[model samples]
Target: MKTIAGILFIVLGILTAYQSKQAQPAAIDYAKERVQILQLIDTESKAFWDKDYEKWASCWAQEPYIRTMGWWKAGGVTVVKGWEERGPRTKQHMEQHPKPNPQNVRRENINIRILQDAAWVTFDQYGKDNGEPVMDMPGLSRETRFLEKHKGKWKIVYVGWLLEGEGN
Candidate 1:
């Protein structure tokens, strides 16, 4: 009876560990992969600053959405929806600023809660613009994005950003 009970306990333990593996990958590997995803995002934001639409759009997966407090609201669509109007609006914003600092770079600190074939990401960005750190309603802008894995590659499906403490 003792032998039987001991064997059962070992089997159950092994099975439990194996079962948990299906939903979560190793933490170290997941963190590294998420860091890579953020680097891709950094490249994308730089393209936006340059107004390089092709490169900017390439940063996202095939179909992506950008929704922010001032950028869009209520079912906004596409990477470049109404871009004709957006260009001038962007120019106006740029006019308010001097040349950005060469060392300035946009950064996103992403904390991934789950990153298997599918992932949930929470992120916040920090940086200086034109030699001054951005100070909006929130100390730093925050965003949450969702990515899906297909054919072993992760693709971002959704992106939402806003200032914390500021209602929108």
Candidate 2:
């Protein structure tokens, strides 16, 4: 009876181990995903600064729940929710500001957390306008971006920005 009980315990332990392994999520390819995410970020920024409304819009998810929030030292806080409100406003802005205001921004201290099809990213950005450093939002500004992958493409779902010395 003791031997039979011991064998049963071993079998149960083995089965439990197998079940646990099966229940675990698969490993993510962080390196590949990071590269893809960085590329998407770059595309979005370039399109925006270039005032290419269509291109910039393509980087977003186009979902009703998407949002953009900002806290600026001079302007205080602003929030734009839903694609219906954001899309037309952004398009109008792009039309009004036809000239390109290319930004020379350097992103640092980027931290990205990826979970399957969703990703959360945060970073510090330092910018220079033309040859002079941007003093209005001096130092590093805080930025956060949330993205979701759909149909094999990653699209921005939310963007948050807080200028230096603001939102503290």
lDDT winner: 2
lDDT per residue (tens digit) for residues 22-124 in model 1: 7676454766777767665666566555545565555545532423232323323224333344444445544554343333443456577645566767776
For all candidates in order, the CA lDDT equals 0.53, 0.84
Clashing pairs for model 1 are none
Residue 20 displacement in candidate 2 (angstroms): 12
Which stretches in model 2 have alpha-carbon errors above 4 Å? 1-26, 130-139, 165-168
lDDT of 2 at 42: 86
Model 2's TM-score against the true structure: 0.77
Write down the TM-score of every candidate: 0.48, 0.77
Report the lDDT tens digits of candidate 2 across residue range 1-168.
Answer: 999999999999999999999999888899999999988998998888788899999999999999999886567887999999988988887777677778767899999999889999999987543422222344567999999998979999999988874233
How far does residue 157 in candidate 2 sit from its true spot (Å)?
0.3
Question: What residue pairs are clashing in model 2?
Answer: none
Task: Give, for candidate 2, the lowest lDDT window spanning 10 residues.
Answer: 129-138
